[model samples]
Target chain A: MTIATFPPEPPPPPSWTRYLGFSTDAKVIGIQYIVTAFFFFLIGGLLAMVIRGELITPAADLVDRSVYNGIYTMHGTIMLFLFIFPVLNGLNNLLIPTMIGAPDMAFPRLNTAAFWLVPVFGTLLIASFFVPGGPATAGWWSYPPVSIQNPLGHLINGESMWILAVALSGISSIMGAVNFVTTILRMRAPGMGFFRMPVFCWTALAAQSLQLIGLPALTGGAVMLLMDLSFGTSFYRPEGGGDPVLYQHFFWFYSHPAVYVIILPVFGIFSELFPVYSRKPLFGYVYVAVASFIIVGLGLIVWVHHFFSSGVPQWMRDLFMATTMLIAVPTGVKVFAWLGTLWGGKLRLTTPMLFCIGGLVNFVFAGITGVMLATVPIDIHVSNTYFVVGHFHYVIYGAAVMGIFAAVYHWFPKFTGRMPYEGLGKLHCLLTFVGANLNFLPMHPLGLMGMPRRVSSYDPEFAFWNVIASLGAFLLGVSIIPFLLNMLSSWIRGPRATHNPWDAIGLEWLLPSPPPEDNFGEEVPTVISRPYGYGSGEPLVEHQAEIERRLQLQEAAA
Target chain B: MTSTTPLAGSAPASPEAAHGHANHNLTGFIIFLCSESVIFLAFFSGYAILRTSALDWLPPGVEGLEWRTPLVNTAVLISSSGTMVLAEQFKAREKLWLFRGFWLLTMAMGGYFLVGQAVEWSGLAFGFSSGTFGGTFYLLTGFHGLHVATGILLMAIMLVKSFIPGNYTGGEQGVQATSLFWHFVDVIWIILFLLLYVWR
Candidate 1:
């Protein structure tokens, strides 16, 4: 075989204009996703505040029923599609290549395409709000029949826009998923075996795989629903011999695993944080990794849990309930493993660590409620109630949102070349923690008292809790102010951060903070030790030794 | 787990290995193909479910969409897949000119197959809005046509890129990815052809 010669020195970094189209540098693409997704997050949160304000009193004071429906609908749509998914995608885009010590994604152009598509679809979805009939009045589920037969059916182009935009978003996700999986599988640095890879990367890989398999059902459902609306097909119209329930089945099939698609990466985020803060290796690396895959596998079978009251057969319902309950086992294993990682170690109480710990508390409550909702009898009672809303917010907002906050604070230095204000971040964390629980915790009671979700008005008796929840919503909005300030101020005025601020072990920190265009200098990393290889009492010595050995090998080879 | 270093003290491997190891671009294509398959698979599954659910197995209204036309389309697609494989083989062997010819053949066959589908679509008595049969048929074939268009565009790009001297060497791996994608499109059509035409 002919031996290939290396180019004497690596070529100069590509121009900025070239980076715009197909740059393989993960950090740049990651920043693109993060900024766009955060913009949507603010829009989604504003929609939530509007919905809460309307429901603060017994009467529908703030908006009409249709307008109220639009608010809640846009809120859920933006949060799920534009906010949470993209945030995770952004995190993975930035960190996965670095964690695994790759120069960039396997396909650079595809990564650019994926990141850019988000803003396009996001603009389409947001613009629907200002269109003729306003944004979609149907819930985010966009269940057909009702969705197909809107009151302003003649005037509303919202449904078409919704489908087109969502389909576009789906395309973006599929591209990102492909890029993530391929990068992880084909581009890992030497010695970074699958088992040795960071848990965050493993979680991201699993989440992306779930996206790969799970999104097609939603795409199929969206197309059928669009046809039912525009083309007059009866894919979901029972009058035309089409079964509406089939739409539910198809929608939930994707949406259910999609819940994991949103949460699994956050789980990885926590997995990374716990060991780092606790100053120990993760207690059970394989357990956490295996649990991530198990969640993906089991996530598909439990979509019927969302529809326990949809008249599915008893045996099928029972099977779904059992599968749903079994999911708790893997989740519980992860919770305990995280606690084990935290036990008996030098715990760091930084803002990121605090947010991660707070995430644990909220997710515990969320998981408990998740198990409760899994029961067939309980789910039937709370199927369309505020309890369901509360349950999901806990998972999405409490677990996923807090996890995003943790990742932002943790990785802010590497991305910006400066450290975030610690005092402001801590303030943000505390206020957010209290605000999130106060906003969502009372809904369990309101749901138990028979308060239906998606209504413009409710009985006077539910007013007190509604008022409290609205107040909490305001507090939550206030809590984000500090975060925004910290982010902006840090970028402008904060001191430059060291490459390894936290003494972290990931390959990302081995390079300069805000890594150069090509990420590494003349040399690319070859993994010398496992991520989270912190030894007790003498971690500095061990890390130095490992670094020196790797540098010596590189020098000899050069 | 083994401590032996694969790249230690050795000159870099051949350009092919370097491209494969360093870039790993094919992995992204494989992953894309996997996702694209699921999208089509979902549509196919919907068709199967609807077919099984229909009272009078095949709907009575629509006609002229017989197995023969689609059968011919299927043959064209399968042959195109063979030509795609040939193109990849030639490109791998550094027969750049031959590779381009096979790609042109595949693209031409793909266009013919797409035109045949449009003709089949026009002859149908039903429209996308008509009923269940209309909905499923248009969706399955419409999405397949979209893939066919994308494949043609990709092939055209590869064909043009082949003429640039330095760009042709590591281009085979990318061609291989496009070939796999073409094969996936063909496989999906086979499933759709069996379900919509032959089974009926």
Candidate 2:
């Protein structure tokens, strides 16, 4: 292998404006995604708060029915289409190149183009509100017939814009997936094999693989709906002799696996946070890595479970029920592996660690609910109830967003070259964890008591839990105050970070905090050992000192 | 690569070096094709569903659609793929002019196929607004035509790129990647031809 004898090209001038503009550099583009997605997260969170506020008294007191529909639909769509997916991709883009010691993604310009599409199309989606019929009100799935023939569809905006936005974002995400798969597969440091790669890269790769296979189906469905809405065609209009159930088949075929698309990378994040904080090797690293692939495979077929009550034949539901339950095996392996990784270890309950542990507890709760829901009878019992809502919030908000916080906090030092305020960070973690359980836990009993989801108003009998959930929603909204301040204040004038403040041994920690342009500075680092080789004294077998020595000499010569 | 081999030290290296510039592009391009195929399959699946569930495949007022044009279009597209294969073979032998010549042939044929599709589309008694049979037929072929148009654009770029001396001297990575994409477009049509034109 050739050690870079020449110095890196001088970095872009460190300025905030560079981020305001387009950059082919993955770091700049990644920060763009993180910041832009955070904006959407706030907007989506506020929409949820509005929904909760409207539900406080068990009557349609606050908003009209259609407006309520728009709020919930846009909330789900914004959070999924804008917040979770892009934020994870942003973090992955930031870390993958440096993690694997590559110069950039396989297609750097395409990466930039992908980042641009998120905001461009995201605005189109959010902009649908200002137009005639307001944004789509027929749920985030926007099932056809209603989507095809609704007043909103009859009007020139709303659901059609939503479809267009989804298609564009899907294309953007597919482009991102292509770059990620290529980068991970073909651009790893010379000695880094599939097994030797970081667990996060492995999970991110698996997630991208799922996105590759699954998202196209969603795109096709959206395009067909777009056609149905615009033209007089009947792809989904039953009156036109088009079967509306076919659209459900197409939608669930992609959206069910999309559940993994949201959480699998967080599984990677938890895997990273656990090993680092516990000062131990990740238990069953291979199993954890391979489990992600297994989940992706099972995830694709189990989609029919979402349609168990939608006139799918009994045998199909039975087969899908079997597959859905089967996914819990690989997923359970992950949870157990994390628990084992934490057992009898010298654990530091840093904010990131607290979130990971709390997220795991919530993840176990969510997984149980998931299995329960996988059973046909139980799923049929709670099909459109708040119970499914509660279950996903437990998994997604409780686990995945918690993981997002942990990652943001853990890597704040790396992203901004400053240590976030640990005290504020801990407060944010506590408020979020407590607030999430309080907010979503009541959803189960309420659903059992027959409270349907997607409603701004509820029956007066469901008042107690709805009130509690609104309080929790307020708490959850307030919880971000410290997080925002910690990040903003820390970014503006907080103390600078050491190159390896965590004393972590990943290749990313070996680079400059916030990393220099031309990551690794024109030098290609070779991996000499497995990524999680902690407690082995020298974690990275690639001699960090030797690379530093060469870099120093090159810089001096320059 | 030979130039860099001299500067390299005696270090343990895996055969992954076999993934030179050519293979890297090819691998990534193929992965893209894999995803693209899933998307096309979704549209194809939609067609299958609509066709099967239809009370009558051509419900009403959809009659007298000539199949001869699409048959010829299929032949034209299939022949273009053959020309693409020939172009690659010639490029591998460093037959730059022959490579360019055959690529032009492929692009010409692809253009002819698009024209044939447009003519067929014009002659048809249906449109995207027409019911499922007409809708899927128009949309699928329209989408495929868009891809073919993109393929022609890529072919045009390669034809122009051929003029730059020494561009392909290192390896035939760029052209091979584009040819793979063009062939994928061609392959999608063969399937589209059977589903949309034949079998009825």
> Chain B in candidate 2 has what TM-score?
0.84
**Candidate 2: tens digits of C-alpha lDDT, residues A1-558:** 465444354333366777877677788788899999999999999999999999889789898998999999999999999999899989988989889877677887789899999999988988999988788888988987667755644646898889989999899999999999998988787788888888899899999999999999999888888888887788888777688888898898889888898899999999998989988888999999999999999999998888788898899989999999999999989988988888877799898999898888898999999999999999998999999999999998999999989999888898687888889999999999999999999999998898888877767899999899989999999998999999899999998776667757688887766776556643566777777666776547456786656545543543
Please, what is the TM-score per model?
Answer: 0.90, 0.93
Over 4 Å off in model 2, which ranges? A1-13, A150-155, A545-558, B1-23, B63-65
lDDT tens digits, residue span A1-558, model 1: 122233464334333453245344567778768877888989999988899889889999888888888889889999999988888888998898778766667777777788888888898998898888888888999987778975555634887898898999999999889888988997776667888789999999999999998898899889888888877887787666577778888899899999999889899999988888888888888999989999988998999888889878899889999999999999899999999999997999999999999999999999999999999999898889999999999999888899999999999998777899999999999999999999999999999888999999889999999999999998999998999999989977897777778877677776666765444422445555556776643332224445544433433454
Q: For all candidates in order, state the fraction of native interface contacts they contain.
A: 0.48, 0.62
The digit string of per-residue lDDT tens for model 2 on B79-109 reads 8888899989998898888988999999999
Q: RMSD of model 1, in Å? A: 5.9
**C-alpha lDDT of all candidate models, in order:** 0.82, 0.84
Candidate 1 backbone collisions, by pair: none
